[model samples]
Target: MDIKKHKIINRYYHKNCISCKSWLPATEESFYSVKKNKDGLHSYCKACVLKKAKESMLKNYDKQLERMRERNLLPGMKKAKKKYNSSLKKKKTQQIWQEKNKLKLKNYRLQRDAHKKHNITDVQWQKCKDYFNNKCAYCGLKIEDHKILFKGTYIQ
Candidate 1:
């Protein structure tokens, strides 16, 4: 209706984006809020800001990765490293225990083999061990001595 009223309405309701040079509604949805700006809205529209940010991230992707690695802030890197270290420690401990209990492990394997192959129960295997005084039948070597002599070897 009135020219001054129309001008005032357009001035307050619409804004031109500095980056895109497009007119958008002067609202929080169209532009980010900026306390420093007189109109309390960013100069660039939301789309322009997002585009610039994406371009910047793509351009500096490697730099960001290096920075994150340096700061130990890369996602999953720390977790993976920790998991690997713990697993390595666990493996080392298991190897040490296996080394210390070599005789026990050999006896367990013999019993398991006897049960699976000959259908011998644990009590029968124990009786057999007692009959031979826990010595190898062919070699006449004690279980402890056999374990040391034939370390890492599987006997049937």
Candidate 2:
């Protein structure tokens, strides 16, 4: 073996993380072992790997969401939504989000179903329309002004 390669291998083989510059015990939890590598261990420790993964996820959050949405639209994906909804992770996330925006969601539903929901009377709904001069309550932007009403709009 070359002198430099031997030194480099020796440095990381003893449970040393190249990225963190710290020494930890050689264990499956602390280091990632690769069969192809001469030392059979990754240069960076598990903590560094996790930190990198989290950073990458945050940086590509929107792109990742778009990709997942596209993937769900592929063939044989009709049951994907049902499966996702049934998952405990999805249920827990939905519960957390709903809990955080209880008042906002309630107001939204009232405005949305003014004719159906008893909490929002027709008279009160009309008054609100009059108050806003028939403009969108949330955006206040005139619908007539925007020719494309439904296009390029996010519900919530």
Candidate 3:
């Protein structure tokens, strides 16, 4: 393969590694390299170029973070977080109230029915009637006038 293709970017003079100073052929796949210049200085290998670029970038980022801290960005951020949490708490409370009220209404209806002293399950009623052949267990009462001295069994 032609090493020259790597020089598609303008090639400076001889290129070398930044850390070890070992010479390397100019190549495009390199992570960092000197942009071509009229001056005859050899281009740096990708590694040295990358180190310089990263150092500058990190320095700028640190400056930006310092500026933000000075401007009190932290307090504004906390207030926004607090407001979001409060809204979530309110929504949860409303949802819980709705669920509890629904269950309470169901139990109220069941209690009302139980208070009326209705004793027999539909199954029990049919069994009692059939076993007695339509005669009341106690008084031998027939259908339409069926009444027994004993109470219907309702476990609850």
Candidate 4:
């Protein structure tokens, strides 16, 4: 290989790491990038550079965490917060509407309870209704003919 193509290896040969004092091969892989340095290679070896970087990160861990917390409240992160707040507002509005419509809500609860007290779903209830041709299961009366009483309002 041409020595010019391997500038660091040719120039430094086998240099000792400043921090670890261990001999490392003079190559791009063994050194950190330093743009301003004459050979564009850091004085410290890659292992020392990484060790110092990790130590600095650990020392300022709390500051990093606080910065991340502040970042989460920034405009870029507002979409998820806005969605959560809007969903909560919608839930409150729905509750208020249900409270105002007592008769309608009562009918809704009766229909829900008709299938079973536990482990029942709207799909299963619809299946049951379809099986009986939308008629009362016990009385055999058409849903429009009979009024089933549950919570004051007669539910069809």
Q: Residues 98-127, candidate 2, lDDT per residue (tens digit)?
A: 799999989988889886756877888788
Candidate 1 — what's its lDDT?
A: 0.71
lDDT of each: 0.71, 0.64, 0.53, 0.65
List residue ranges in candidate 4 displaced over 4 A. Answer: 1-12, 72-156
lDDT for 60 (candidate 3): 68
- List model 3 lDDT by residue over 14-126, tens digit each: 34554656655554554343346432233565556655655654446556445655654433457656676688777797467657799886888799988999677889977
Q: Residue 121 lDDT in model 2? A: 73
Ranking the candidates on TM-score from highest down gives 1, 2, 4, 3
User: Higher lDDT: candidate 3 or 4?
Assistant: 4
How accurate locally is residue 8 in candidate 3, as Cα lDDT from 0 to 100?
34
Candidate 3 stretches with Cα past 4 Å from truth are 1-14, 31-42, 66-156
Global fold similarity of model 2 (TM-score): 0.38
Give model 4's TM-score versus the native structure.
0.38
- Backbone collision count in every prediction? 0, 0, 3, 0
| Tens digits of lDDT, candidate 4, 1-156 | 234323354566665677887767766888877898666777799878866765664566567546755656433557767776688777798678877999999998899889665776889888989999996676454564433211122343
lDDT of 1 by residue, 1-156 (tens): 223212234457777787877777778998999999777888899889877865664566667567766665554577766876688787798678779999999999999988886677889888898999987776465676545443433243
Instruction: Point out the higher-scoring one by lDDT: 1 or 4.
Output: 1
Check candidate 4 and list the clashing pairs: none
